[model samples]
Target chain A: MTLLVTVFAAIICTILWYKRKNDEMRLGTLCFLFWGASLMWLGDAIFEYAELHEEFFTPAPADMLNDLYLGLSVVALAMILWLIILLIKDPKGAVRRALQKK
Target chain B: MACFLVGAAEAIVVTVASKAIKASESKKELAVRSKGGEKAVDALREKQGIPWSRKLMWLAYLLWGGAFLLAYEHVWHGEVVPWFPFLTAMNDPGDTAEMLHEMSTVGVTMAVIVTVVWALLCVAADLILKRRANSPLENA
Candidate 1:
């Protein structure tokens, strides 16, 4: 479930990044982040599949909720990190000037 | 919170480790090249900063993605509400297939919402950056 979520996010991000390749919003970074996540999830799915075999596909409801929470949390964490990076880069020095004023 | 904590911890560890490795590599470059001087050091740093660090991006990706997947097995048996007041087809998870299909509907809706929000954020950030660049203060 988490793998599916990340893959979906990655595919969307990749398409967005490709279309806005020349933009200063640094879509490339976003693409890299999502794709990296997708790959990581892929690895996890493989290991789980190996361990649980057929049982992996039909997860219990409780299991699904946990996966859903995990998926949401991961997406949130990525957004947080990216926001921090954007602030640091402050491509326009907005943060820098704000700090200087302080 | 457990999922978030693990993800945050991994991000911090990966970033610090990458920075340490980069710092060490800088020193190694200085040792290997006797006459490259300050120019060489600057070049190395530039290379590191050009378009941002792949290590940093990958760290976020792996930690975020990996942590979530790891948490799934640990929490999969948890209960979830499966109800759609308007769409009867989307309600009542009688079995795994029906449940997953319902979940997929929710996932698609959430993903679409997230993507739209992210794009808007990028646009706002770009506008802020451009505004600063064109400011009278900057021109002065």
Candidate 2:
């Protein structure tokens, strides 16, 4: 479930990254984050499949819900970190301009 | 159970290397600044493309982010514990061996994949920067 969510996020970020040629937002970093997480989850999924075999196909509803939450939380956390980086870098200089106005 | 440790370990090493590279780059920048100021620093940057330290730091960030999420997931599954010998698999010899195997296989594979992706990204960025630098409009 977490893997699925991360893969979805990765796909969305990749699309955004490609669409925004100027890349002022630095969406590449977000894409990297999601893709990296997806890769890690893929490893976990492989091991879990090996251990559970056929049982891997089925997951408890509560566990699925928990994983969904975890996945969303991870995405949100990545966005927050990216925002912090953007603010620090201020590639657009929006923050700097706003501050100078005060 | 402890597979994420591999990525975490690599992240730690890469992060240390990145810090060292950053320090060296800063010293070089200082030297350039002393000789010719901000313009010299800008020229050096244009010549260098992207700093190696920044590229390495990006890899470190990716690895650490993956490692943290995996660790959290393992903890959620109760495969990891709060106590000493933190991984639950560490309690038993068979599980320990299996855990080590997983780390060597799945963990290492994931780390390699992430590293490869980062390398490709770095290469692509360098190519784009090079093209832009070579373009006629930029020179004018």
Candidate 3:
């Protein structure tokens, strides 16, 4: 159930991000953070589910997943910071320059 | 927890320092542009005055850093390791060291991928915006 919710949230966030394509950096950073957090939540949910089903001893990959999850969170946070800096330096100007390069 | 807290502190300090440097540069640029009789709007480019949103973003970074460390030391080391009862996992005699190494690798890899993707997206978004701004119809 928790996994379902996480996946659903991820999907909704992704759709919203695409809909706001023009403001991709801002929306993308937000979505990335959501995704990272959801992934971590999913890892925990899986562990709990396994425990409930009496399959708890089944060499869970929780550590690996947690590491990956936290790593992704940090990355997302960094991206958010970068976007903020860009926005502060010159919100419109930065975006304009970036678009010009593309 | 300690490691995570330390990491968070470091991230905050670094972010503030960088912002200060940028602010100084912005001030200099403002002075130069003003001396050249640039438009008043040019003064808005001063980096010294960062928006509240950007400051919040920096805080987010620090929180995330601390969370990563906490997750690594507490959840990863405590819950995850014991759960993964595989011989491969046991290959590392020093459990803490192994976990830390793995976490570091994951962190670095994610950071690199996110950075690259962000750069690409920023470039793409900028191009689209510029085209729209430059259109004759829009100007009219």
Candidate 4:
């Protein structure tokens, strides 16, 4: 699930980046982030499959649900991290203005 | 989760590099300041570093919140075991295997579902973008 989610994010980011051809949003950074995440998950899946062999074909539902949670959590964390970067950069100075308005 | 973390780390690297490049360019670069004491630049950022598809940002954020909340509820309720190998057949510490084979079918199923949903989201967004571009107001 994590792999799939990252793959999806990577694809979406890439498309948006390409369409806009603009880096002000740091879409390139975002696109690379998701893509790297997807690859990592893919590697983990492969390693687990290699270790488990045939047993990997069947997994308990509870465990699957756990993976789903972990995947979603990772995505959330990624967004949070990106948001931090955005706030620091403050491209439009909106935050600075709001803060200065006593 | 580990994979995602690693990806985020990689992204940070690229981001910092991009910033460094911009900072190096003393000439061709201008950092304007507003009355609010904020530095402004001529870049691709629409506002506050948001992408062109502002809706997409909010949508992704809302969905992520929902998923995170729901997942947390399930984890808290013990509906899903919080094991290290949640995706592997080794989910249960008690369960042991002689030889490894293929990835878990259940895991594959979950991955597929996530990918499908994501594809749908992107396709919908793309369609909306295209339509908006064609709208008379945009052309006018």
Candidate 5:
């Protein structure tokens, strides 16, 4: 259920970002990436919490699956930060010109 | 809860910092243009008439900062649950709590490092942007 929600959220945000490509597009893109990663992280956290509480009995395979999900979340976050740095940097030609002026 | 609060504070700090940097940049720009005989640029120096979009950008910065803080907290310490769940595979409640406390120490350290790096990057980006904006082709 949590995974579904996360995927849905990412889809919606991505759609919105594409729709606004010219208007603060970088900001929109960064936001979409950030939220997408966040939702995924939230989903895994929910699953881990459930496992910790023993709400769902998980076999060895399931435990491994949970670990994989957690690892993905970390990777997603790192990507989000990279996206942010790109967003914050001056847009393409803007940076090159800025550098030339210096 | 502590993480959330700290995140909120961080949001405010980032907002203020971004605004200060922008204002300074604009002032410097005005000073340059004024010296170059562009009297019209002096009007911008008053700063009483900043555009609405810039204001919105500042708000966005605040929101992003808050979200970053929230994510940092969530990663270090599990989200708070009102009642414990019934999963046996979970970490022990007592141990979880202890781990969270320890996690906060790590979180603080990480936050400081990330924030410093972010600030430095922003400064570099700003300088680069300013130079680009001042270029002759851009001015033309």
Candidate 6:
């Protein structure tokens, strides 16, 4: 479940990065982060599959719900981190401009 | 249970290697500057592709971030403990075997995937840089 969430994020970020005229947002970094996470979850999935064999596909309802929440939390955390980096880099100088305006 | 450790370990090694590479690069830049001043250093940079150290740094950052988050998740699930052995899986011999198996399989694959992706990104970046350098507009 976590893998699925991160995989989506990675794909979306990759597209954004590819389409960007300039790297103001540093979407490339975001893509790397998501892809790395997706890979990590993929590894976990593989291990789980090995352990459960046929049962791996049939996760319990409560387990699925918990995984969904965990996955969302991971995604949210990644976004927060990326936001912090973006602010620090200030590639577009938006934050700087706003601060100066203030 | 301790699968994230593999990525963290690789990240540590990569960070050290990146620092070493950066130091070597600085030395080379200094040598160039001594021979031909600042212009020479700029020329050297122009001739060189993006530093491998920077690429490694990217990998290191990715690994570290992923590992940290995964570690947090493990801790949330109580798979990891603050006590002596640290990992709950270590309590039982069978669980320890399973944990080791997960580490070897999942942990290894995670690291490998990140490395492969980083390598591909590096290749793509090099190609793009090469094209930009060759472009007439860029030269102008």
Q: Please, what are the lDDT tens digits per residue for candidate 4 over residues B89-112?
A: 355443323112222442333334
Which clashing pairs does model 1 show? Answer: A62-B76, A62-B77, A62-B78, A63-B76, A63-B77, A63-B78
Tens-digit per-residue lDDT, B67-125, candidate 1: 44444433433332234332233344565465455335433333333334444545665
C-alpha positional error of residue A94 in candidate 3 after TM-score superposition, expressed in Å: 31
CAPRI-style docking class of model 5 based on DockQ = incorrect
* Per-prediction tally of clashes: 6, 0, 5, 8, 11, 0
lDDT measured at residue B101 in model 4 versus the true structure, 0 to 100: 25
CAPRI level of candidate 3: incorrect
Complex DockQ, candidate 5: 0.06
Give me the TM-scores of chain B across the candidates.
0.39, 0.94, 0.51, 0.38, 0.41, 0.95
Per-residue lDDT for B132 in model 2? Answer: 89
Cα lDDT tens digits for candidate 5, A80-99:
76466765665665656866
Error of 5 at B75 (Å): 9.5
Tens digit of per-residue lDDT, candidate 2, span B3-102? 8899999999999999999999999999999999999999999899999999998898889878877787788789999998899998999999999998
- The ten-residue window of minimal lDDT in model 1 chain A covers A35-44
Which is the leading candidate under TM-score?
6
List TM-score (chain A only) for every prediction: 0.83, 0.96, 0.45, 0.81, 0.38, 0.93
Candidate 3 per-residue lDDT over residues A1-102, each given as its tens digit: 323443554577579778874763455454554454444444444545555766543435874465456555444454565467557656458666876894
List residue ranges in candidate 5 displaced over 4 A.
A1-21, A24-26, A29-64, A67-102, B1-5, B12-79, B82-104
CAPRI-style quality class for the chain A–B interface of candidate 4: incorrect
The whole-model lDDT of each prediction reads: 0.56, 0.88, 0.49, 0.51, 0.50, 0.87
lDDT per residue for candidate 3 within B1-140, as digits (tens), equals 12233334544665676577668666766787777656543555433244433544444443453344334445434443435452233556686566456445444333333334434655665576667768999889
- lDDT-based ranking: 2, 6, 1, 4, 5, 3
Any runs in candidate 2 off by more than 4 Å, and if so which? A14-32, A45-70, A76-102
Highest DockQ model number? 6
The CA-based lDDT of model 1 is what? 0.56
Which digits, one per residue and each the tens of the lDDT, describe model 6 over residues A23-101?
8888877876787778787778876888899999888999888888887888788889889999999999999999999
